[model samples]
Structures are given as C-alpha cells and as structure tokens.
Target: MVTFLAIFTAFLIGFLITPVLILVLKRLNLIDAPGGRKIHNGFIPSMGGISFVVGAIISVLTWFSMSQLIEIRFLLTAFGLMFLLGLRDDMVDISAWQKIGGQLIAACIVVVFGDIRFSSMYGFLGIYEIPDAVSYGISIFTIIALTNSFNLIDGLDGLAGSVSVVTFLFLGWWFMQAGMIGFSMFAFILVGGVISFLVFNWHPAKIFMGDTGSLSLGFALAVMTILFVDSNGNMNDYEGWKFSAPIASGIALLIIPIYDTCRIFTKRTMKGKSPLAADKSHIHHFMMRMGLRHDQVTITIVLINSFFIGMMFIGSNLNDHVLIPIIAVMAVILGLRLDVITLSRVKKIHRETPPILSLRERKKKASKPNVNKEILEKVNLTQN
Candidate 1:
C-alpha cells in the first residue's frame, strides 16, 4: 500500500541521512554538551532533526500529488515555518518570547488560513457550539500549548521520539480507516522518519533531535489532533470509525506531555517563578531521580501513554462528559501519587546518604571520559 511505502521511504532516507548528519554536526562542533540540567555524558551531535524532517517532507511530496497538497497547503506552510523556527533556535538560542511569537504565527496560519479551528467543545462543560471568535482563540491556545508541552518532554534519550512514534502510528491508522488519505499519509510519513531517528537516538544516543525536531514534531501533532477532533465531530456513531468521545480520546493520545506540562507550570507559578523556567521537576526527572535509567523511563512513559490510548478505544462508546471526567480524575490521582512518592523517596535518600559521600561519588563519575559507542558506530557507518 502507498501508506506503507511512504513510511518505508521516509525511514530509509532518515536512516541513511542521520549518520551523515551526525558527521556534519560533529565536524561543525554543533553538539550538546553535558552538565547543567542535562543528563547525557560526552558531546552528542544535535539538530539531527534535519534528517527526519527532510526525510518526511521528501516522502510526503513523493507520495502525495501537488493538487492534494493544495488541500493542506497552509498547514504545510505552517509546519515549514515551525521547523525553521526550531532549526534557528537549535543553532542559535532564541529568547522564550521570540520562540513563542514564532509559534503563535504558525498557529494563526493554521487556524485562520487553514481553517482548522475547533468549532465545538462536544458538550464536556454543558457547552456545545462556540462563537467563531471564541473557537479561534481556543484553537490557537491549544496549538501553542500542545507544541510547547511536547517540546518540554524531550529531556531524555528516545523519550520524545518514542512518544511521537506511538502518537503518529495511531493517528495515521485511524485516519486511514476513516478514509482521510491526506492526514493518513502525513502521519505515516513522519512516523517513518521518527522511527528511523530513534535508532540513533536510543540509549547512549549518538544524536539528539534538538529543538528543530521537537518543535516541528509538536506542531505537526497539534495540527493532526485538531483535524482529528474536527473530523470526528462531523461524523456519527453509525460511521463505525467515529469516536463518541473525540476530545477525550485526543487527550489520552497526548496525556503524558500535556499533564506533565500542566503540573510543572502550576508548580513554577506557585513558587513565583517564570512558568518556562528550566527545572528538573518534570515527571521524567522524578522518575530518573527515583533511579530509573533513561531507556527504562522512556519505556515506562510510553507504556503509560499506550495504556491511556487503549482505554480510549475501549471506552469509545462513552460520551465526552463521562469519559473526560474519568480521564481527568485518573490523571490527577496518578500525578498526585507520583509527587508524593518522589518527594518522600527523595527526602529519605538524602537523609540516608551523607552529603560529602554523594558529592565525592558525583565527582568520581564526572572525572571519567566517555565516548558513546553508538556515536562511534554511526560515525564509522557514515564513513564506509
């Protein structure tokens, strides 16, 4: 099928280009160094997002005709702008406001020109249809929030990429079954690239996708999510593929990042700090400090995400009012439990370990040299 071919083509391109991209990044010395809040060891080539983005775009153009492209032209334009914004930030750090301004511009293009704004709330809050102005405002906020939420979760090896792979795989399959070829192809192509990128981005990662990958990916996801909600709203239960709880299902698909973002932002605001202030208070950070390895944490989060999505399918017959409440309550309870466990365990660990011994152990580990074997292998692969 064309969808499978699109995925394979993108994967092959991404797989081939990533090693070469790594070599270029290393030569250019565009690498992410360890220290600060970052946990990786040694220098790792960054902006590796170029490989996957390029692969996905090329695959898209190859499989989808220009006439078909016109249907989503504005969305693709916004996607390009987002990719460029992130590429710029990864190369030269941009201010938070500047990055947000770019994201706003991209979101506006999608909402205003692409006409993909949400028209209804699906009666979750005893509200159904909304005013056009209100719908535009909500849609823009959703895009910006979703984009940043995803970008913030790219803190560990394979974390963002794995989550993205799952999100797109499900979205693409759903679209395909719904007979939306454009969205289906779009999702499938990106999945190919992300899956390929994961090879080099796994534990002991040779390359990081950097802001370029995360921002573009986040933007693409936001678009797909809106389309998913809007499309499903236009369909009825008799259609078989139509979900009775579109909004709730959408939340389940992206619950981890969205919930983590909300939790972290609330904590920062309560402490009188800027919401965007970088801190190790993210859920992944807590899991890591609780002694989980990078791969372990990534897999754990992925499985949790999978569980939520699976539940959405099983409860697809439920209305938004019932499904949304259940999802919200479950998320709140799980989040609170994580906070309790992390705080108590972290305090207990600190009490047990002497400060001097901890400092000495950290210093001993920092003094050692590390050249990631994965990077070395990729470098060699590119050369030969």
Candidate 2:
C-alpha cells in the first residue's frame, strides 16, 4: 500500500509540474520547432524528461526506505554518468557516435565496479552454459543494445514515456516479489515520474523529453534489468525465482524496442544498407506514414507493446521450446507489416505499380526520360 501511494504521489507531482516547466521553457525560447523528422508543431519545450527525472529522483531519495547515500556505489556512478551525458546532448545536439560511446562507458563502469553481468540466457539460444569472460562481454554489449533500443523508440509523442511507465511497473512488481525492495521502489518511482510527465507530453504535446530525458530514462531502465546475468554458468537454475521472474519480466518490458531494433537491422542489411544508418523507417514512422496521426500512432504502439508484454510474460511461464515458436510467429507478423511499407508503395502512385517490381525495373523508370518534360517546359515558358 505504501509502495502504491509513493508511486501515485510521485506521478501526480510530476504531472502537476510538467505544464509549469513547459511554460517556462517556452517563455525562454527553449522550445522545439516542427522541423525535419521531428514531431509537427510550432514550438514546444523539450524538457519534460528533465522534470520526470527530477520528480522521481527527489521522491525516491527523500522517502525511499533505502540507505541514506546509496547501497550500490557503481549504480550511482553509472546513473550520474548517463545523466550528465544525456543533459549535455539535450542542450547541444551530439552525434549518435558520441551517445553510443557514452552508454558503453557507463556500462563498463557498472561492469567493473558493480559487477553486474549476464552469465547466461537460460538456454534461450540452446547454450546451456557460458564462461565468465564470455558472460562479461555479452552483458556489456546487451546493456548498450537495450539502452539504445529504448532511446530509438522515442520517435513519437507519448510512445517512449508511456511504454516506459508500463515497463517499469512490471519490473517494479517483479522486484518486490523477488524481495529486492530498494530496486522495486526505484522502478515505481520511475513509473510515477514518467506518468507525471506524460500528462503534458501526450499528443499535441506541450513539451518533449528531448535527448536528455530519453537517454537518461533509458539508462535508468537499462541498469535495472539489463546488466544482471545468470551469474551461474548453467541453465538448470535459470528458472530460479529471482532469475526467471526478473529476466522474463525484463524482456517483456522491452520486447517492443528490442524486436523493432532487430527487424530494422535485418531489413536494412538485406537491402544493402548499413544497419547504423538513420532513416524514417522505424515501426512508428511506418505507422505514421500509413496516415496515423500523432495520438493514434502513440495509442497503437503503446497498445501493441502492452500486448507483446503480456504475450511474452505468458511465454516466460512455458518451456523454452514453446517460447521460441511464439516469438518467431510474432517476429514474422511484424516483419510482414514492415515489408508492406516501402518507398515504391509510399510514392504517389500514378497507377498500381506492380507489388513485385524488380530493382532493375525501378531504376529503369528513374533512368527513363521524363515524358512530361515538354509539358513542364511549356508551363514554365508561359509563366516566364
């Protein structure tokens, strides 16, 4: 009951303060303009993430039943590192490379000091065991991957923040069940903070979380479920209470972003493009291009993410074999949907361009001389 109250109170405080902060940022001209690939709007303050962070941090620190300073030294260090990195990027746009490097650095700090590492995947990949060195390497890479996955998913208003609220709630609950009360408190505090911010951050957003907020929030989430591995080198204990519940819940919480990342990488690589290259090809972008408005896109993705979370949770209770097939089916469905969105299809179709047109034929059309050139030339001549 106390936990619930803390979560509710934290969210209310955040929600209550978000509008005031947005107004302040707007008055100071620290607002984002509707330009480029960003959300369409005149200008909105992009500091909602900051407010959420502040609200959650203060709430937890002030009232959490944890130690005065911090129980885990490296945890605080890693968070501080991410907060600084995020705040800097938010203020002055940093390149993606820099962001990647920063996340890696923070992960390494935890790896070295806190010793949070993934020991195994409980035979998810059919590997029953792994070595310590292998465990550390895999865990660090996984942390970075998961951290960026959350950040990349923040392309639409309310999508990232709302999904996060759901994710953290599940994680916090799992933590409590596992007897890790401090961590559970952290998760609820996060949920409260983000929900509060989302009040003003919904569609027709008055403020954005910007990179500062997204990266920081992603960092916090990443640390919660990301760095911890099986610790043991066997799958026999993978289903242990602490291991299975936290692992399964964590994956479900993040399945949306992780699945999307994998889909994008595969699609891009198959098309002879670099996976790291950025384009408006994300799942959210495809839905928007399909004529979904900001709020609709936000609602659709949030609901889908929630569905996936529920499905994954169900799978977690079953055998690995059953879980694998379920995941494959979901992946196939998402892949087909993504394939339906293409430049050829999106182009204003003068006619029903064949669905299976070869690249050669497409390029041939590009190489062909414009038949309407004379008409355009005539029109230009008349205007002149």
Candidate 3:
C-alpha cells in the first residue's frame, strides 16, 4: 500500500511540478534545441530531471528518515556526480570522456564507501566460492558499465525516467524483501522524483532529462544493485545472505541497459565506428521506424523494460539450478532475437528511405498529386 502510494504520488506530483520545472530550467538558461539527431522543431528545457531529482528527495525525506540518509554515502556520491555532470552537460557542452571520468569516480566512491558489489553466486556456476580480488574487479567494472548504460538508454523523452522509476520500484520491493531498509527508502525517493518528472515528459515533452537526469538515475541503480548484493558480499560475515546466482539477479535488475549497451557496442564495432557514436540505432529508434509515435514508442519500451525486470525478479525465486539456467538462457535468446528483428526493420528503413524523405514526409502535398491525368491535361489546358 505504501509503495502504491509512492507510485501514485510520483505521477501526481511529477505532473504538477513539470511546468514549474520547465519554466525554472528555461529561466536558468538550460534549453535544448531539437537539432542534430534530435527531431524536435523548437527549443525545450533539458534539465527537468533536476527537478525530478529534487522532488524525489522531497518525497523520500518526507516519508523516510535521516538515519537512512546518513548510511548511503555511496548512493549520495553517485547521485551527486551524476547531477553535477548532467547539469554541466545540460548548460554547456561537456566531452564524453569527462563524463566517463566522473562515472569512474562515482563508481569508486560507491565501491569504497557504500560497499556495493557482487562477491559470488549462490551456486549457478557450480562454484559457491569467489576471491576478494576478483570480486572487487568485477563489481567495479559492473558498476561503471551499468552507470553508463542508463545514459545510453536515455535517448528518448520520458522513456528513461519511466523505465528507471519502474526498475527502482521493483528493486525497492526486492531490497525490502531481502531486509535492506535504508536502500529501499533511498530507492523510493529517487523513484518518486523520476516518476514526477515523467508527467510532463510523457510526449511532446516540454523538457528532456538530457544526460543530467538519465545519468543520475542510472547511478542510483548502481547504488541499489550494490545493496542488493551487499548482504551476500561485504555487509556481514554470515550465511544469512547467500545467493546461488547473484549475477543472474543483478543482470535481471539491469537487463535493459546492459543488453542494449552491449548490442550497441557490438554493432558499432562491426561498422568500424566508435562504440560511443550516437546514431539512430537504439531500440527506441527501431520503435520509431515501426511507425510508433513518440509517446507510443516511449510507453512500449518502458513496458518492455518492466516486463524483463519483472521476469528476472520472479525467476530469481526458483531454487532449481537447472530451472534458473534454462530460464536465463531462454530469456536472453528471446531478447536478442527481438533486438535483431527490430534492428533489421530499422536498418531496412535506413536503406530504403532517401535522406530527403524527412522533408518529403512533413511537407503538405499540393492538391493531392493531380492523379487525373487526362482530365488533368484538360484542366491544365483550361488553366493555361
């Protein structure tokens, strides 16, 4: 019930706060023009996620306590870095390398202070053991990759926030179920802010998250992910928190970004292009090619992300090692197949449509193409 209220509050407050947020962002000179790969026609504020973050802080603090707040230094650090970086990018241009540097710093902060990382699996790999050194290396790499995945998925308006809010809500429930209270409340606060921000971001957005909102949300996920495994990792020296498959659970929580980022990088590498190169190759871009409007595409992808995360959450409960492996394999296969199918369609459209078609699609056809040629010749003669 409390969770539902939080969700509802996100929608209600986010809806209300958006306009004010937009005005404030504009007033502060944080505007995004719909140029480059962006298809919008006018200037829109790109820092509304800042407002969402603020609103989330307000909501969570109101419902949760300061005690919980003090314990999450890692989360705070990650969010702070994201917010600053996002804000910096929102206002002025920042190099991709600079953002990457910040993400590394944020990940280190979480790993060192927040103590979030995976140590070992419950037994999916038939090895219930892990080395401390290996764990640190793997966990750090995972955190940085996941953080950037969030940014990569932030290509469409409202899409990033909606996916994030849903992901956090699920993780919050999971954390609470796993007996991690501080992190759960922390998740709720961030969830609230993103949800609220999405109210205006639904479609024809007055503002976009830009890198500011998206990066912060992704970093927040990294924090929860660490907490999700902390009990099994470094939180205690007990057998109470043992997972046969931490990697599986962690991957499920972050299925969308992790998968999407890998796919993007692989394709970019194949094309002799920089992996970080931005083009219309994302899943949402395919959604557009599939003739989905912006709102429809955003909603569809958000729902798909929710579905994958939901499946991961449910699949995590099965104690059968065989069942977990089978489920994981099948899920990944289906996900990859769908990605390939979608990308094929996008690539087809790219091949078929001339670059000039964009203006052609938008232009008003004069008098319906004059289809009646013979009558048209007479009409033309009359006109002449």
Candidate 2: residue 266 lDDT (0-100):
86
What is the Cα-based lDDT of residue 37 in candidate 2? 74
lDDT, residue 75, candidate 3? 76
- 343, model 1: CA deviation in Å? 4.1
| Model 1 clashing residue pairs (backbone) | none
**Residue 62 lDDT, candidate 3, scale 0-100:** 56
Candidate 3, overall lDDT?
0.71
Q: What's the CA RMSD of model 2 in angstroms?
A: 8.3
- The alpha-carbon deviation from the true structure for residue 186 of candidate 1, after best TM-score superposition, in angstroms, is 0.8
Taking the tens digit of each residue's C-alpha lDDT, what string does model 3 give over 1-384? 655565556556666777887888788887877768786658888877777776665555555556766776557757787789888887888887887788788877877666676656555557556787776777778777887887887877677877787788877776676676777767776776676676677787778887778878888887677667556433332434344345566666677787778777888999999997888777777667765688887777677667766565465445436545654576568667766777787788778877786657656575357487788789989999
Highest lDDT among the candidates is held by which one?
A: 1
Best-matching candidate per TM-score: 1
Local error of candidate 3 at residue 287 (angstroms) = 1.8
For 1-384, candidate 1 gives per-residue lDDT tens digits of 878898999999999999999999999999999999898999998998999999988998888877668877888899999999999999999998999999999999999989998888877777888999999999999999999999999999999999999999998888888877787888889999999999999998999999999999999998889989888876766654877888998899899889999999999999999998998889899888776789999998999889899888899889898898889898899889977887888788878887997889999999988889999999999999
Error of 2 at 6 (Å): 2.7
lDDT of 2 by residue, 39-143 (tens): 566777886777877777677666666462354457667876887888888778888899889988999887766777765666665765678888778878878
